[model samples]
Target: MSESLQTLQTGPSAAAPGDFGWHLGMVLRGYQFLFEEAVEGMPAGIRGYQILSTVLHRDPPNQQALGAHLAIDRTVLTYLLDALVDAGVVERVPAPSDRRARKIVATDNGREILAQYEERVATAESELLSGLKEPEADTLATLIARLAMDVHRSQPGSSPCEAMDHLP
Candidate 1:
């Protein structure tokens, strides 16, 4: 196993109740670390991959909707989209219903890169959760997805990705 994966499986030393946040921070860092190598060539690391994934999956109505889903600022999203466009991975198209509004779409190259990234990410995730049995891992995934959706619903206007960061 890779060193980072090993470290994550073993984890840091235990923490006191009051240090729960610290422990979670370490855990999140480990997860990010696992993806670091896989996303090395991508723009904005995981965030950029997320933007691509959102574009491919949700087919959101426009740039604003895309930003809302990812919880990225409008200006930041524009900057990121610019890079993706330059890379020939994505495009901003004229919205059919409104000339002023623009929609985001993935080009063929974007779709191919996204497909490759998704495969690598899936492998990394499976390794990250190697300690869990299949059923347990599935349960954890379900719970986390539900939690994120619930938070997103409760906090209107906040991106589901950012919603987790807002928890006390």
Candidate 2:
């Protein structure tokens, strides 16, 4: 077995000084709980925010590309898009180049809502990382971003969160 796998298999008492999996898992769990709460009022919670944010950031090529960028299933993306439309956060405009297809776009209200959600999410993130000093937290965030970029580059179509889909 690989050294890392072995380290995780042994309980803390018998394991190496720190187990990466355990630490990462604990952090993810904490963030998930906090994030769920932070975006609870959103259309589909975190997912709705993701779609809205993506639209605000770019001119989507089409619904399929949007779903691919997010690593969301096409069918699921449709449902999320419907909710976002109902919430007045996003709209499907006819694709300029392909009249047959629709492109997702954010509304002015969507941008405003995203800004509010950003504040809440940032606060939740700060609370989750409160154990770390500011500098330490910044360092951790930088390192994680680098790692995510590497994963994204390694798997051309995989988003950082869904990079695991490309793993063996």
The C-alpha lDDT values of all candidates are: 0.83, 0.84
TM-score of every candidate: 0.81, 0.80
- List pairs with backbone clashes in candidate 2: none
Alpha-carbon shift of residue 17 in model 2 (angstroms): 9.4
Model 1 residue runs over 4 Å out of place are 1-20, 157-168
- Which run of 10 residues does model 2 get worst, by summed lDDT? 159-168
Judged by lDDT, which candidate is best? 2
Clashing pairs in 1: none
Give the poorly placed runs of model 2, Cα more than 4 Å off.
1-18, 156-168
Residue lDDT tens for model 1, 1-168:
887656655746734346757766665666778887777798667788998999999999999988888889999888999989988888999987787999989999999999999988988888888989999999989987898688778986766445446645
- C-alpha RMSD for every candidate: 8.5, 4.7
